[model samples]
Target chain A: MQPQRIAVVGAGAVGSYFGMRLAEAGHDVRFLMRRDYDAVKSGGLHLSSHLGDLSLEAATVERTPEALAAHGPVDWVLVGLKATAIPDIPKLVGPLLSEGTRVLAIMNGLSVDEEIAAELPAGTSLFGGLGFIGVIRGEPGQILHQEFGAINLGHHGDDPHELQRGVDLFAGSKVEIRPEASLLKARWEKLCWNIPFNGLCVIAGGVPVDQVIEDPPLYDAAHELIKEIVAAGNADLEAHGQSARIDGPRIAHLFLTQTLGMGAYRPSTVIDYNNGRPLELDAIFRQPVQRASQLGIGVPMMSMVASLVGKLGERVE
Target chain B: MQPQRIAVVGAGAVGSYFGMRLAEAGHDVRFLMRRDYDAVKSGGLHLSSHLGDLSLEAATVERTPEALAAHGPVDWVLVGLKATAIPDIPKLVGPLLSEGTRVLAIMNGLSVDEEIAAELPAGTSLFGGLGFIGVIRGEPGQILHQEFGAINLGHHGDDPHELQRGVDLFAGSKVEIRPEASLLKARWEKLCWNIPFNGLCVIAGGVPVDQVIEDPPLYDAAHELIKEIVAAGNADLEAHGQSARIDGPRIAHLFLTQTLGMGAYRPSTVIDYNNGRPLELDAIFRQPVQRASQLGIGVPMMSMVASLVGKLGERVE
Candidate 1:
């Protein structure tokens, strides 16, 4: 397989890990990060795991669009910021989007492809990628790879084969790309787990995973939330004349079991709250519940949880 | 009338305010304090207000039971600890509870009187009192007196004439006592306002009254919480063969309006949180909710708010 050129935008945890892994595999990769741009430029890139620590001395790191244009057009742009940060991307790097340049939003929540595609150039291919990683910024130049480091890739509209080419490019990287024929199923399944766990963990003040692992209220809430997301997703799929693929309830239970097995991994939202960063409450929770409302699906549990968390976020002074 | 001999326990804020006032009124008052005895002895007791700043140049303040008893046996003991601190009083100064002594527990929430009564000896009378004073230790010896300083006194389960005598003693001092014949109503009415505003302010990062005065959901939530407390209090009243006095819904509105008018006053829970002291969650919130369950009253809104706030308290590291 030919080595593909990749750009890892907002290279914090998930981006740094995946980018370094792909670069280590001898693919052409560059990290576009805000904080570690200086350190990463000096040190190339560093990725550390409990398994082993690998430093990519030859990988490129840059901060601005001018720097990226100097390296020329990339084949894949792994957009890794929170969904709320999606609107700011075009303003950040209008020069980075060349013809055939695929922007894969490797973030949480649902319908991110539509969000990204609406802003990109007309001929630009939009890809939706769901990352299943528990990576944290261990230090300025290192990402602590935690649990469930995998990715699911699918196209926005009717095409699945085109999305696979982007998925296959990430095949030999540290992250797994599980290419699904149904993008709707893939997106819904990720949202099913992300909304409850992230929103609850953040709102409940980063209570340990074991605290909610066996707890019936939390588990039940997660299951109920997923059901609501599934109902809403199905409504969207039906409106778009497409078939829903994921079994939301079953996926919820499986995720709960996985949570029990995962052994004390803090959810992304929890980490964000602990670090005093802006939470993705709007994207993962509010937007999903809003979409559910649009579909006339009652989501009392998620809505309540979202409301509490959203309000709590406002008070994070 | 001759000034009644008085003993004030837990000389912080309310206790110190009442103690100094009683001492100034020519009553032989002894303050039984744990921490600030040495400071008060060195600097003397200072109470600052717009009305006037008063000082007790030669006041009786003691840390130990033996030192407190040196001032002679008292007719009345005004206990003014935060509700959670009530359990510790029995062990701290058991010598203060003498025969035929009336113990006015000027603390917040329900069960404080019961907790004290359980520890009291036979022939000891107990009273319930609530103070709407915003007093804090300004320094080692000085107490800052903010606005709306008033006291409400009544008997929990005692003779009205005896309760009036207790009220008369406080009235002789600068502290104005709003004598409620039914103490149960006074206690419940305070709880109604407290459970909502205090818990909400503390949990929502100590939101001062001005923030939520105009907001509908917050104001509504406060109203709902107070109503539930009223329901629980009414049930408690019925179980104990007493008549409920205060109107919950009406008082909730009054409390909200008063808080809004005050503008700068933060609830006691917020002060505790800011001072890095343990919050009164178990006493102020959980205990009442447990009692509500025992009384077979449905307090759904208050329960959720309590759980949410309790969770917030649990996160305070």
Candidate 2:
């Protein structure tokens, strides 16, 4: 495959990690950054990973999306901002999109691709990239990639070729990408982990994943949340005419069992909460909870987490 | 009321305040102290209240129940310890209990009187004293009374006169005591406030009652919790052959409205959590959540709070 040109928008930890990997694979990658723009422009971007360390001393840093677009439309624009910043997708991502430009949204939360797609030009190829890893943004221009560098790639757009393109971008990198036939199912699978871990971590006094896994009630609450979310996800899948149904109890057991080994992994939501930054409430909680409600699914754990996470988020403002 | 003989068990802040008052009013009130025994014995006890300041320089500090019994069985025994300490009820309150002695349980949570009664001798006159005040134990031997020192007193025994006897004990004191015909309803009424505020405060990152009131989802969650608890209470009351039933929406509105003026009021549970002390889980959340489950009521929010609070409680251990 020929080398690709990629523009990374909202290049936070996850975005920066993937874009850096893609760029290291000989793809021409440019980052549209703000907070870390100066640091990245001068010191360049660095990813300290368990698997390996990677750094770009002469990384390209574009101050604005307009500046990023001026370099010409990239093959793919990676929308890696927090779900809370999804609303700014149009202004930040719109300028970087050409008619053929595909998007690989590397953000957590449900219906984010749809949200980003709705705001951008119609029929644009939007691929949902759910990153399953422990990564955090450190002192400017640095990514602390703790473990599990894997991506669940699913296409939300009509272009079937977009899925292959999404997979190809990470083909030569150390990062493993698993392409899914159903984006909805992949997102829901991610929710099984995110809704419980992210929500419980913040709601249960901003503790880490191990705390949620260790505390029986919280651990039980986590499973209850997973059960509720899985059921809702299955119901929504059915409603959307997809034959993708999640097995609730099994998924709960799997995620919780996996979490037991996660040690003290702090989900990004807890990090955001402890830092008093805005949470991805709508994309992660409110949207899913609302969808569950619309489907007449009773999501008490989901609802509780949503409101509590919502309240926790408001503590910053 | 000729200066009654009173023994205060679990004399924390609330116990110290009321005991100091009774002692000031010319009654013989001895406190069975543990943590604050030496300080109280040396420096006496103090009550810094909004209504007025009160102190007892010569406060009686009994090291043990047997030591307390040496002064003879008091007319009334005030149990003001945290509900978590209720298992020691028999050992702590037994020495001070005579056939004629009336017991006043000044603790929070569901069926505390019943639990205490079960642990004590049968046919004993028991009273439930639900205190509505913002009081916290500060420095040893000190009581920080923020506002509203009122106790809803209700007889929980076969003796009809026990309520009046309980009322007369606090009659001359500055602390107001309102007698209720039904102890169950009164306790339920108190739960209307405690379940939501206490549970939500700790669960939502050790925030105050105001945050629970101010945040929309938390505010809504608080109401949802109140409704679940109130329904469970009503059902339990009916099952117990009581005619009392709580009007859910009205009570919810009243408590939430009341909380708006309670700026930054940290509930005792939140305080216990922040201090890493064992929470009054069995008395406050588990017992009630269990009772609700037994009644076949769906208490998602209540269950979530119970498990989270339970987990949060275990964090200290």
Best by TM-score: 1
Candidate 1's displacement at residue A161, Å, is 6.0
> Which tens-of-lDDT digit does each residue in B1-317 have in candidate 2?
88888999989888887888778778999999999999989998888888888888878788999998998868888889888787898889988888788788888889898888888788878888888888888899888988677898888852457778778887778878888878888888899899889998988877888877986667777888898888899999999898878888888888989898899999999888888888888888888888988999888778878877777777765
Best by DockQ: 2
Docking category for candidate 1? incorrect
Candidate 2 displacement at residue A166 in angstroms: 1.8
Question: How much is the lDDT of residue B191 in candidate 1?
Answer: 81
* TM-score (all chains, Cα) for each model: 0.81, 0.74
Itemize residue pairs with steric clashes in candidate 1.
none
Looking at model 2, the pairs that clash are none
- Model 2 RMSD in Å is 5.8
Q: DockQ (Cα-based) per candidate?
A: 0.20, 0.34
